[model samples]
Target: MYARISSDVEGSGLEVTRQLEDCRKLANSLGWSVAEEYVDNDMSAYSGKRRPAYERMLADLRDGERDAVIVYHVDRLTRRPIELEQFLEALDAAKVRQVRFVVGDTDLSTGDGLMVVRILAAMAANESATKSRRVKRKMEQNAAASLPHGGYVRAFSYAEDKVTVIESEAVVIRQFAERFLAGESLRSLAAWLEDNEVATVAGKPWRTTTLRAVLASGRIAGLREHQGVIVGPAVWPAIISEEQHRRIRALMQQKAVSGRRAPRRYALSGLLRCGKCGHPLYSAARQTTRRYVCVSGPDHGGCGRLTVVAAPVEELIAKAVLYRLDTSELADALAGRTAQDEALAEVTEQLAGDRAQLEELATAYADRAITMRANG
Candidate 1:
């Protein structure tokens, strides 16, 4: 007996149970002794997903372990025409052609019955395709309306409704954004989240990839994204400002282009260049002694003619840095940096005002309060 239900949304397995009962009754009435039953609940035949029980039944049929097959319906046996053909081939190889269906009373013993099964399978496949198209269209419409996509778990900083911001998680999200923008590495931020007992929506420990995704998502900036494109503002309130989100994205792109590396083991790892070729010297070790050497190869593109003892060079650079920090020129540079910081703050505020004005113009145009030309 082979019983399968395409979808068991409630996961009750009642449909599969009902199918097996009907199939068993049909087999008993036909006076056919059943050796075993194959059941595939919550599995779809048209989706091309693996159905373990169905495959086992086919294996048994081909091995001649089963002389006959019984199912609740033809569609239950298979919705795909190709799979129906494979089933027939399996029966032919075993030289056992007895097959029965409780609902459609389909029999593989006759040529007409085979044709009917093929037609039913084709119809089922068409119906599945239509349903898939309808569902995808609905989802696209929902995305255009800035509605939340369906998911089992809520978004990181949002509630189950997907619109309401969870204050606690939102706070953490802001902290993540701020720290990341301040030049903290994703790995460091992930460790901070783990150390602070902050778990993801799925109750899993923080990872760099997961942290990077949340930081880069437009959802936190009150934007609706569909198929990896930001369509418009989302229904939910923004966690951090759009400006911060844009900066995070830009920084992430820059990091991706340049490629990030693990923390430097030595202070002067990449700071010193070769005197001969001016190429960056890589840190290397010989026995217990560490040194910086210019490597020659397609990979390094260096002259490989210069080498420096790591200890002396590192110590000299450290002393120089410390001495330079106490100089009047350094004091003057610090003062200049303070002024630059203030100027940057003013520019940032002005940019925010401009962004707000642009948003108002967009809103006016959308609401038909102003013409597109006037909004522009």
Candidate 2:
């Protein structure tokens, strides 16, 4: 059986347990067996939030662990028409013939039943759209009134009310901006935080990415941000001056522009992969020496897999490329080039696939399609 309740509805005393109880009663009355129970609490179907238990249940059905699904209602199963289509496809492929609901029944064995199911699904989708519009309008109204947005967690520098700054946290945020503008690198700032036993808002060890995010956030300057841009001054007191905020932002922009100028510095850039975790090796400098280190940072899913001297690695690759080019005999050139081409093709395909999957995982993580634990 499947059950879900959005956070808003959940606040009004509606519980997933009630739905599960009703669904179980219906299943028992029909003499149906439930292979598994899928419950998604505080998840919004309208917002396209990922439902891990629901997805797991669908996978179980697709794998023939179960040939039928029982939910409290069709809407409880899904509100997205696209997801409904995918669910129908999975059921068809698995040869599942029945879908039983506590409030209603949908027959998949007949054309008319399928048509009726589609109509119900369309209504659910419409309801979801309507709900989304209402939520967005309410949020806009709140924004206009300078009211704090409802969130499970407050901003790093702010208290639960989103207006009062945590003094200690606010001090750290100010230090981040001031120190960054004073020519301290993000790595240096991160190291300083770690050395001082300063933990992040999440109570994790400070990292370069974490420091950068804190330094770049407009919220730290007591400015409201919605969808990436700062809207206006927030209700809370600013930790740093507006001038300091502007300077820090400009410094970040300057570094970004310099980075874009030499996006690829080394000849073998993007060619090297970690031997351990199989992630891409990024070019980095350690004082005077340049090395290709695994791109994985504390937050980037890397485990410090591999690090190699950049000069030697690039020289070896260059020599090999030159050797193939300098070959005089057509037969020798063709023989060497053919093997090189095949190796290159294989690596290219593998890299492409790996990059695509990583990118998808990143997007899903950003969209809350996957949880922090699941992403890891």
Q: Provide TM-scores for the models.
A: 0.35, 0.38
Q: How much is the lDDT of residue 210 in candidate 2?
A: 57
lDDT of 1 by residue, 88-136 (tens): 8988989987887664454567644565466445444444434444468
> Per-residue lDDT tens digits of candidate 2, residues 16-51?
876787678778877988878888874555667788
Q: Give the poorly placed runs of model 1, Cα more than 4 Å off.
A: 8-14, 42-44, 135-376
Determine the C-alpha RMSD for candidate 1 after optimal superposition of all C-alphas: 29.0
Off by over 4 Å in 2: 1-151, 264-281, 284-291, 294-306, 309-357, 360-376
- Candidate 2 backbone clash number: 0
List lDDT for all candidates, in order: 0.67, 0.64
Q: Which candidate comes out best when scored by lDDT?
A: 1
Residue 144 displacement (Å), model 1: 12
